[model samples]
Target: QDNRISIWSVGDLGNVGLNGEYQGEPQLLCDIRHNGDVMDMQFLDQERIVVASSTGDVTIFRHHQNNQTLSANQRWEKAHYHVDRQASCGGAACTGVICNNPEIVTVGEDGRINFFRADQKGAMRTIDNADSSTLHAVTFLRTTEILTVNSIGQLKIWDLRQQRNEPSQILSLTGDRVPLHCVDRHPNQQHIVATGGQDGMLSIWDIRQGTMPVSLLNAHEAEMWEVHFHPSDPDHLFTCSEDGSLWHWDTSTNVSEKPSFLHQGGRSSTYFSHNTINQSVVSAWLSNDPTKDRMEITNLIPNQTLSVNSLDVLGPCLVYGTDAEAIYVNRHLFA
Candidate 1:
């Protein structure tokens, strides 16, 4: 990430400031109205960021470190939309995006998944109706496989190598129907993933074992939105919810299991969940920390409340955005 090219918004294409630390006064970099609200964005490399919008458009912006400028390199329109076997037309809104080097994959509200090459102007491949409901999130299981969650609370693994549009494996949340909002893979384990949904519930799925979740817990009072693992500290995790709370989970004590790798399709893969989590699934995994086992949660902001829409962690620092159109930044998260 370019430190200079810092502040941006998801709800609008408003004026963005280049320097995040410019507290004295704000400096505007670019102010171009986007096609629709920006849904997601990902780093293509150190130099470029690709942004996906609700209007089914994805744009790549190149940050010129030397000049302190950002330039639009390319844009793909209607990359994800609805089209039946009969070629029926129905426009769709883009929901999720993932970047794996030269390949770009995007899923949309129309339940379609599209793959593109950064150099190409349009989608090279399309999986129509990847889900019957809105596809909310997607992540890569391997270079040739992708995992996606839908409004129906179903998680499916799509094998890109297959000639068909069907997924190779599917996992259901429960007997009840609750929309899944976001999904994140474990930083250390390959097959482990945490899914948060509309009912304020969180579940962990071990893809190699089967479609069933290893553990489920009531994580929030309202709908859960985002989940992320510490980049280096696999023993910890963070989650945000519409209930206006941020939760920090510590599972250091439960992390005693030996690291194991599984082989499938002739490829050896490691579990993303840290050692203890790789083998066991407990409801309150956070309470395992021996040093501070008594206090498992620390509300990032205890005095006031606002629905946390998104949040992320990087080492000791944390940043979150709320529905009130405000951003909170905190340092020394682990401290």
Candidate 2:
């Protein structure tokens, strides 16, 4: 609520025990006051970060690693705003931001989508009425395609290549409208996507298939705030919720190749071949047989009593922030 951006170093989280516990606090590196409430932030590159604000503005900040400080680099003011005729237009909160290198995409409460380049002051493309309801989150399906989740529990795929403002495809949950809060795409499979809703349910979708999600797993007890797929290991997933819990989902056991590993002594050893593994190693998200799909869900933070608002996974480390005004880092996630 203070509207400040702080940086910390979690590089020295130390080793994990056999039972998967680690000790070490993240060291504070720097803090900078932001112009408005920070809604979302993403690392644009090694030295820069792009931030979305409640004031409907997007700002870029450069990290001066040598001095452990940050400085504002560029700003795009009023990128999103309410369209009003009688009253003066008001800024609508920029709810989410995603980075695709030089290109940045932002979604807002105004139901607008803006695309901006890192070095440019103006938006390259703007989709004014991308949805009637507020857009909550977005993820890239491909370089030219992005999927956005909105307050009405609908997911729409927008093709950046097309000049048309309308989405190419739309998917939604059945029954009552439950706002989706966050979304993430599979690291290895562009067709697979995951979204967490206000109902605390996790929905897995195969965009290549029908309009409905393939699986809806009962997850957190309260609103799920964020969901992320491990960048290097797609089989592992992470989610945080307003229930004050963080979950690690392991879907490796659902892969059909588990049975083939037992017959390594015979010609079945050929199953280890790259071509064979690639063909057989289907993501559990696409599994049709629900009964055989085994997924292990572990609560990473069982004692935390405040909402975990955001989380990110890189290599074997997981870092998350909470409503208690704290950040936690867990290292050696595979252990």
Candidate 3:
């Protein structure tokens, strides 16, 4: 038997026998540690995994193939250095992006965007610059600009070309000061951006105009968790919330009726959770090819003592890690 992560077939534990799926001696993929809870993760190509943890550390791991299974080759602990005193990651949390090369872009709990690049020998570069705020979400628009949202319901666009003190553009919500939870740019139109906030609102803005949005909608009843633009079209988009709802919006149509459900043929596209421990659900894009719709959800894996902090998906397999010194690369649920 291989001393790797074991795989068990679905059923009661009593049903696990010698004929089960655990005998192949699967490889021990990797072990990722976090000081606090992990908030998000991004994979760079097929070999690296980037993680954003609640302890304000953004780390990267290299994947190696051994015995026909994947395992971690190397790791970078404390990938993003925090400016504030080392404390539990609170307020607007940090996030990572692999925009152009192997640069790790993370928004700090202190409202700064830090960049770390991979050198020729794969060592991460020292953080070059940091922008301010309790930055909730940070992402790239082209290679030179990044869009970010923060606790004060303000959207700021940073021009990396200018080594300056502040962002090139700043936009705030018109009516209320609801902490923005997520921000994204339209996949087709680089000038357009969308934002979701604690006020259960979604708004679209064009940088050509001032900070106020061109289109706004009360997208959800509860706090919005995430929002994304369609990979192929700027007209369509998706959003999810704590209220257990997923909405599909078409920005090209009547702005008053922008948000619609993603259910197919009058069926729900999501499952409802009864308890709070498993209530927080996170979704990530496995592929953004625009030719295919591939996505995956990561959460606590039952029966494993460690808490699942982050996860990734490739084809029909789910790769995840836990708080108790464990990482998993397992098969996904398929029809």
lDDT of 2 by residue, 61-167 (tens): 99999999999999998888897523444788999999999999999999999999999978899999898999999888899999999999999999989988999
**Which parts of model 1 are misplaced by more than 4 Å?**
1-32, 83-90, 257-295
Best-matching candidate per lDDT: 2
Q: List candidate 3 stretches off by more than 4 Å.
A: 1-35, 65-98, 120-132, 251-335
Model 3 C-alpha lDDT per residue in residues 1-335, reported as the tens digit of each score: 11222222232223223423222334434443444455665666566666666555555555554433344433444444454334443334455444456666777565556676754333332322444546678778878888778878888887877767477888898666788878777554566677887777777666665567755666566777677665543344666565544555543333222222223245534322122221122111111111122222222232454333334333334444445554444442221
Position 48, candidate 1: lDDT: 81
The C-alpha RMSD of each candidate to the native structure, in angstroms, is: 7.6, 5.7, 12.1
Using TM-score as the measure, which candidate wins? Answer: 2
Ranking, lDDT, top scorer first? 2, 1, 3
Reference-based lDDT, each prediction: 0.72, 0.84, 0.53
Per-candidate TM equals: 0.79, 0.89, 0.60
- Pitting candidate 1 against candidate 2, the one with the higher TM-score is 2
Candidate 1 structure quality by residue, lDDT tens digits, 18-130 = 42321232345444445567788788888788878766767887877666667778888767666642333444678888899889889989888989888897678988868
Clashing pairs in 2: none
Which 10-residue window in model 3 sums to the lowest lDDT?
282-291
